[model samples]
Target chain A: MADRNEILGAAQGAFNADPAASMAAVAEAAGISRATLHRHFDSREALLVELGTRSLDQWAGRLDEVDAEALAASGDAPAIRAALETLVLGYVDDADGFGFALTDHVILANADLEERTQVLADREAVLFAAAQRVGVLRPDLPPRWFGHAIYGLLVSGREAVRIGDVARRDVGRLVLSSLLTGIAQPQNQDSTP
Target chain B: MADRNEILGAAQGAFNADPAASMAAVAEAAGISRATLHRHFDSREALLVELGTRSLDQWAGRLDEVDAEALAASGDAPAIRAALETLVLGYVDDADGFGFALTDHVILANADLEERTQVLADREAVLFAAAQRVGVLRPDLPPRWFGHAIYGLLVSGREAVRIGDVARRDVGRLVLSSLLTGIAQPQNQDSTP
Candidate 1:
């Protein structure tokens, strides 16, 4: 029998290819029987809830690894930006695994997932607030807007990479620069043509 | 009898509310029988194709109204920026009606819609290239990246409005400014804090 993590991986791949894939199909993809799949997860909704929980957990782990809370509390613009960079790059690197959960309607609408997402957002708000206080971020926009903007940029970056419009390796800089400076080339920052 | 446009509008609304909504449900929503709906659209796919075509047509119309081509051809930074502003603001204003068609998988996968999307992209590329020439847009990123970025921003902005995180009237400025200047407050353009 496949381990729970292995089963979840198979299910994620199955759903990534087809959003409406059934639990039986996911079990087949994992080289297991439907009964076995049910033994692991009672229903498709249960499976989705598990995936959502795992994804949020992974996100929280990343924040902890980067010491994001301490960095944000430090009230240093450069430190906050560095932590933001780590988070963005980590997400871009794991975009394939994390993308589905981040946008999945089932995951998003799940009450538990919604609460977990709010927790992640609140943590991010600390970093954004620090950046704003230190003059690294725009004060005009609400702190929550950064959360939405980062979400948008990551989704856009993933699509661009998938379409071959942008190389995967360069997504980090492209996303970070776009987030920080917008797309327009500023006169003061101008270096070359 | 509901006109074709009326049926299309109803279908758009139905699909917006429920992406997997059945044709029978759509007909009921339109206050017409299934037979009447079939007389206008042979199948759900046909209805979706028509909606996709209409959405692309609406997008093209916005570009034409803004004279995007002429503005791009002028190769003047401010004029090109003005045209880009118009396009972004127009889409933001119509985000509720147009959002579904833009992101629907069925529409995106259709060859006909793909071709129309390419035509629109090519037209927009001219504007992007011109902006790059005058240093309005970043020359480092591919012109195509802007298209993906705008799509992401609009989707994010729509969700923000739907969740009440952002006011409907504010989406235009939020998206436009984020596109033009990004979220960071540069020292060169810093105003009152």
Candidate 2:
């Protein structure tokens, strides 16, 4: 079998560029022959299966990078914005692997995905709750809803970048702005601005 | 093949309740034999292919329901909020079918899907631009970003509902609040409330 890191790097490159890229192309990218690629991954689906598992593993680790208590201890608006920026950047970097893993039935159908996602959400919910308690988050909104909204923007911005609607670099602000304040320009009466 | 409507209704019901529902379960829900279901859809893949196509077609029609000109001419905030609610509810009702269509390769891979999405986005972009022109939508945000954000929330909220992370009824406020103003509550000065 080929080196896991080599194959994954190549496969991720292919997937990031074009999620539909053939396995043979991935092999070539990895400096391996098609036969070697097949030896490592019996089929395209198999490659994606590995990609899904690894992607989640990496993603699970990424969530821990955000220090929730520090964020909560800090000012609500700036802290929440910074926290979401961290999340958005992390998601943007791994958009391809995530686009594949988060969307496909093979990835979504995994028995642990729901639990794993909950674990992540549960962590973020603490931040949202703390932000709300400080009166930074809207009182009418649920604490967990902020997490979902940021996540929505992440995936949506990723899809936009994938379809060439916007450049990858451009989506960071777009996602954050939409998540933090919204699209509406504040009126003179609006204070946050 | 079985009746298209009967099969679609049952398939959506099954998928909404349990996205991983087997074809046999879908057939049973439709009051059809497994053999009949197989005749109608040679495989689950085939069913998703059909679902993807139909979902986009339905989604395309829903975009026209919002009237930008009328909204712009009237009061901005509440009207815009009301209009968005209409779209959100329509989407929530069909969230399951959409969860499958919008995310899957079959739907995304369709050459027409991208064009169809752009056309819908183009329509909503007009509303965003007009709303900004009316001083409701944000000035710094690109007009098209509004469409992306709303579309993002729609799909994200749909997926959350599919997974039972939050009740479907709860999503309307969650989405609108985040999209219109943001998740953060105003502290001392903001008066939109």
Give per-residue CA lDDT, model 2, range B33-62, as digits (tens): 988988888988778767766776776666
Q: What local lDDT does model 1 show for residue B37?
A: 97
> Per-residue lDDT for A34-111 in model 2, tens only?
988888889887787777777767666666677765776665666665665687677767764566566666566666
Model 2 chain B: lowest-lDDT 10 consecutive positions:
B184-193
**iRMSD values, candidates in order:** 2.8, 4.8
Candidate 2 residue-wise lDDT at B154:
76
**How badly does each model clash, as a count of residue pairs?**
0, 5
Error in Å for residue B154 of model 2: 1.4
Off by over 4 Å in 1: A20-28, A33-45, A188-193, B20-25, B33-45, B187-193
lDDT of 1 by residue, A33-127 (tens): 99999999999989988988887887888889888788888876777777888887887776667665655656766877888788898888888
